[model samples]
Target: MRIAVAGSTGLVGSQVVAVAKAAGHSVVGLAREDGVDLTSPVGLDERLAGVEALVDVTQSPTIDIEAVKFFETVAANLGDAATSAGVSRTVLLSIIGVDRVPQYDYYVAKVAQERTHRVHSPGLHVLRAAQFLDFPGMAIRWGRDGDTTTVDDLLSQPVAVGEIARVLVELATGERDDDVIELAGPRQERIVDLARRLVAHSGEHLTVIARDVPEPMRNGALLPGSGAIIAGPTFDEWLSRQPA
Candidate 1:
């Protein structure tokens, strides 16, 4: 089987490449560094030619409205081109509970991506994955004071990036679909707690402050719903494996 992985240079996408190759599939890497501009879709048709499946794990550069446009455009261009090229299936890696959290900038765009792609490719398989175990580390970017970090507490079931990649490959080679599959970690934990642990583990002296965030973050909006598939490695287990 031949599979094309979008955002192939990313953390999750790179794992998909490795996993697919190990599983004996011919992998096509799509990335800006590889001369594939997903935003513009130049030479994209030629790239999709003879490709059996396309797994999109593309992410935006910014966390604002640009993310929405990025997903929308990529969804339209990729789905249309892939269909024209006779690509059998389209697989997407999305946020698990994005729809319930409209106040978020990125989550809004993800929902749009899902809707836009299905119109062009009816065989799109949407995998709504949970947060990555390393997500807490991202809190540092929210803005860090001299010796304190404001990490909002949110209910999250974080999965390992490798586990997400494994599931992505299984969806790509197996079948076509209009279904949404939810992927989550072994258990749930507080985002602030994870952030504090990461800071201590990394030997940071910053004092972690749990600040009140928007209602969207405080509620269980980002957590997986009922019937969600639980993937491997609890947060503690995953963190333990990472280098200190």
Candidate 2:
């Protein structure tokens, strides 16, 4: 199989590239670092030539409306280029429950991406993944204010990035029976707790604070459904492998 991974250098995409190659598949990395601009890609069709599947793990740094424009443009470009190049499958990695959080700009942007891809991309498969296990580190960076870090008090079943990547490759190469599939970790946990543990494990002096979010988030909207696939090491298991 010949596969192209958009955002191929990212946390999940990189793993996908590695896993696919290890499984004896040809892989192309579609990323700015790899000389492919997703927002306004030039010669993208050439890059995707002979590619059997294209898995999009792209992300926007912004949490505002700008993210909406970024995803929409990239999806349209990828969809068109893949069609022209005769790519068989196009997979999009999305967040679980993005539709339930309209008030949040990032979630809104994700929903828009899903909608755009459905319209433009042929053989589109939506893979709604749970929060990553290391997301607490991101929360610490995003919410940091001197010595204090604020995080959401919401619950989540955060999967490992490697697990997500493996599943993405599986979905890309296997038969496409479902339009949408959700993936999550093995157990539910509080985001705030994970943040505090990460801070403590890292020996950081910052105090972790919990903040209440919107109702949907607080009421388990971010959690994967019963039909979702669950696989990954627990936080404690993964944390033990990390350097203190």
lDDT for each of the candidates? Answer: 0.86, 0.91
Tens digits of per-residue lDDT, candidate 2, 1-244, equal 9999999998888899999999999999999889999988679999999999999999997988899999999999999999999998989999999999898889999999999898878789888998999898898899999999899887889999998888889889975456899999998999899999998899979899998888888779999998999997988888889998
Using TM-score as the measure, which candidate wins?
2
For model 1, what is the error of residue 100's alpha carbon versus the real structure, in angstroms, after optimal superposition?
0.6
Error of 2 at 1 (Å): 0.8
Report the C-alpha displacement of residue 204, candidate 2, in angstroms.
Answer: 1.8
lDDT, candidate 1, 28-130, per-residue tens: 9999878898888677879989999999999888778678888889888898889888998899999977888787788888888888888876378989988
Model 1 off-target regions past 4 Å? 175-178
State the local distance difference test value for candidate 1: 0.86
What lDDT is reached at residue 199 by model 1?
87
Q: Which ten residues in a row have the lowest lDDT in candidate 1?
A: 174-183
Tell me the lDDT of model 1 at 117.
87
